[model samples]
Target: AGSPTEATALVCLDLPSSQVEVVARSSSVAVEPEYLSIPEPIVFPTGGGKEVAYAFFYPPKNRDFVAPAGEKPPLLVKSHGGPTGATAAVLNLGIQYWTSRGIAVLDVNYRGSSGYGRAYREALKGRWGLVDVEDCIAGAQFLAAQGKVDGERLLIRGGSAGGYTTLAALTFHTVFKAGASYYGVSDLEALAQETHKFESHYLDSLIGPYPERRDLYRERSPIHHLEGLNCPVIFFQGLEDAIVPPNQAERMVAALQAKGIPVAYVPFAGEQHGFRQAANLKRALEAELYFYAQILGFPLAELIEPVPIANWPPPR
Candidate 1:
C-alpha cells in the first residue's frame, strides 16, 4: 500500500484487475489530515563547516491551533538509538506527538549513523561524543538560521546512545536550551565497564579499548563534566533497564539536584531498556511534554499530570 501521508492503514491488492482496495486502518480514531506533519529530508553543514549531516525535519501542524505571528516553533533535536542507527521517512506517532502540539522535530542521522555508507558510519569511531554532538548542534542551528525554529528554544532528547549525545550536547555546548534523556549514558567509562557482554566491547571502536584509553572516556563523559550543564533536563528511565542501567539516569539527576538545575526524573518500575508497557510509554511521553511546557513557558492545550521539576523558579 502507498502512504501519501503519515498514518497507519491496511490495504489489499486486487490482482485480477490490478487495483488496490482498502481493508481497514490500524486506529479506530480518525486523525484529521491537517494535524499530521510531513517529514522533509534535510542536509546541512556540520559544526566544522566541512561536511554535512542528514535529518528529517517535521514542522508543527494542527488545524485548530496557530502560533502568534512572528513566533517560530521550538525545535526538538532527536538523537536515535544505536548511535550507529539512522532515521527514516516512516510514520512515527512519537514524532507526531510533538509536531501536532506545535513543536518541530529534527530526527538526526549524525556521523557514524548507518544507511549513509561505511565511511560515514566509521566517522564516529573514537569520536562518538565529538562528532555526533556536533552534528546535532549543527542541525538545530541550521533550522534556526533558516527561520524554521526559535533559536532560543532549541531542545534535545535521545535514548541509549542518542541519550549519550543529548547529555554531551547539553554538557559540552551551549546550543540547546534544555533536554530529555531516556535511559542515556552519562559516564562512558562506566558504560564500557558495566554494560552487558554483547555490548561490552561496543565502545572499543566507538571510543577505544577500556583502561588503555581511559583518559578519553573520562574526557568525553558528561557525568564528569556536569558543571557545564546548567539548563533544565528531564530524564525517563526504566528502573529494570540493563542496557543503560538506572544508575545512568540517577547519577545525572542527583548532580542536577545538587547543582540546583531544574531537573525531573521519571522511572518506570517493571519496564526495561526501552519501555514495553503501553501505559508507561504514554506516561513518559506526556511527562516530557509537560516538562517542556513548563520550562518553555508555552501553555498546553489540554491538562496533563505535572512532573515535579527540582530547583525550578529559584526560591526567594
Candidate 2:
C-alpha cells in the first residue's frame, strides 16, 4: 500500500514476462503531490497490556506554507463502523481530505474489529462500549506521547457502529475536545428494540441479550449519561434511517441543548441508514468541517456558510 505522503499508483506486475504495467496515477486537490501526508501504521498498548492497531496520517505538506512556529497539528481519531469492521490501508480520498487541510487522522482498528483473528474480533463481544472506547483513547494518547499531534486538540468521529463508539468516548471520557457522530447510536436499549432483523440480536453478542442485560444497556448508553459529556458535539443523521432511527439523534440533541451544551444536529429527509444523495453527502462533509473549524479555532480551507450551533459560548 502507498504511504500517505504519496498518491497511490496502480501497477500490474507480470512475473513470467518480467514486466510492469502502469495502470493509473492517484489524484489530489493539491497542486503539488508532495504536500500530501502519507499514512503510517502504528501499534500502541491499551488496557490489559494489549496492543491496538491504527494508521496515522499526518498533516498536509506544503513547501510554501509553514505552520505557526512551535505549533503542533490537531488530531482526528476515526472509528470504523460495524464495531466488527476493520479500517483498510487502501488509499482513501477521505483521509486525504483532512490531512491536506492540516488535520492529522488516526484510523483505529479497536478490539472486536475484523482483519485480526477471531480471538481479537471476539474480544469486543460482551464489552462493546468499554473495549472500543479504551482502544480509541489509547490511540490518541499514543500519538500525543510521540509529540506528533496537539494533545489538547483531540477529536473523534465515526458512522454507524463506529458512531456509537464516538459518542461513547465523548460521554464516558473527556479525552476528546470535540466530536462528530454520523447516525451513531445514543440509546442502546432503543437500538436493541428498533433495529432490523439482521442485527436485531447482533447486540446479543456485543453487549449481551437484551431484556436480560437491560441495566447494562442503560449504563453504557450515552443518551442516559448526558450529564457526563461537556465538550461540543455535532451530529448528522438520516431522517429515514431505520437502523439507528432519527429519534436517537433527536433525543441526544435535545438533552445537550437542555444542558446548554454546544451542539448542532443536521438531519436529512428522504435518506436511509446511510446517505446516498450526492448533495446530502457534500453538505454533511462541509458542515462537519465547518463545525470542527468553529469549535477548534481553525480557518477552513474552503468557503462554507457556518452551520448554526446552539448554546455556543462567546470567545473567552
Best by lDDT: 1
| Top candidate when judged by TM-score against the true structure | 1
- Residue-pair clashes per prediction, in order, are 0, 6
Candidate 1 Cα deviation (angstroms), residue 97: 0.5
Per-model TM-score, in order, reads 0.92, 0.89
- Writing each residue's lDDT as its tens digit, candidate 2 over 189-214 gives 99999889877799999998989999
Angstrom error at residue 249, model 2: 0.5
| Whole-model lDDT, model 1 | 0.90
RMSD of 1: 2.5
Q: Rate the local accuracy (lDDT) of all candidates.
A: 0.90, 0.85
What's model 2's lDDT at 248? 90
Off by over 4 Å in 2: 1-15, 18-32, 48-50, 62-64
